[model samples]
Target: MEETDHPQYCGIGIRGVAIGIDSFVWIALLFVAIFITAAFTGQLETGSPGLNAELSGAPASMALGLWFVLALGYHTVFEWRFGKTIGKALVNIRVTSEDGSSLTFTSSLIRNAMRFVDWLPALYLIGIVGIAVSGQRKRLGDRVAGTAVVGS
Candidate 1:
């Protein structure tokens, strides 16, 4: 019998657990962002009067912006450096191009940044649909970048 040339990917399209883990990380980061926003917004009522309401909006925006950066930027940089996110590492998976090579920085950046389109209008429903239908278990970003997540 001849062996397959391609690597075996996670059957359920990156697996529920991997997505769950990544979602957990994002949720924690979002919570922190909300807390920081609340703290500066004087909504905390913790008696920190020095925190100005006028300044609150900027910090909140900054935190929110950082959250986006952490999601996309960190993934691009760290995955380029290590071929895996903390979540992917925990799940023993790595992302690579379909041709079997580490993802390029340009591809990673384009893919992650383009998540805005994938997430447009609502609950990432488009991205989820894309992932489910893709043979490579890739979401919109993955498809745009020509990449796949596979077992390590």
Candidate 2:
């Protein structure tokens, strides 16, 4: 019997879990950064007026902006250099080209950049549907980038 060349694609459940883990990792890093900055500025003490003011008047927009940059950097760098994020590694999955080759920087950037589209309508419903319908189990970003997630 001849062996097949087809890749074993990753399903949405595992992908969703991996994303959840990645989200937690990013959130933890953000919290650590905030605490470190607060400590450096001598605002770590709860009773300190500076700390109270900082917390009370904190700009959520700034945090959201930082999060956007962090996520873009994290996903792009990992997929470009390693073909897998920490979450994907833990899940034993990786992203690769449609031809089953290593991901290129351009492909990684395209996929990660289109994450906004995948997140449309909340909770990645569009991406979920796309992956389900795609024979190779590709999300919008993956399809646009000519990439797919598969078992490592």
Report lDDT per candidate: 0.72, 0.83
Worst 10 residues of 1 by lDDT: 46-55
Q: What is the TM-score of each candidate against the true structure?
A: 0.72, 0.81
- lDDT tens digits, residue span 1-152, model 1: 02236776654545556656787878877766666666756665444564332334677687788678777876788678887877788888877877768899998887778678877667667777777787766778888888777788
Which tens-of-lDDT digit does each residue in 96-141 have in candidate 2?
A: 9988888999999999998999999999998999989988999999
Query: Which stretches in model 2 have alpha-carbon errors above 4 Å?
Result: 1-4, 32-58
Error of 1 at 46 (Å): 8.3
Question: How close to the true structure is residue 125 of candidate 1, measured as C-alpha lDDT?
Answer: 70
Judged by TM-score, which candidate is best? 2
Candidate 2 at 108: error in angstroms? Answer: 0.6
In TM-score terms, candidate 1 sits at 0.72
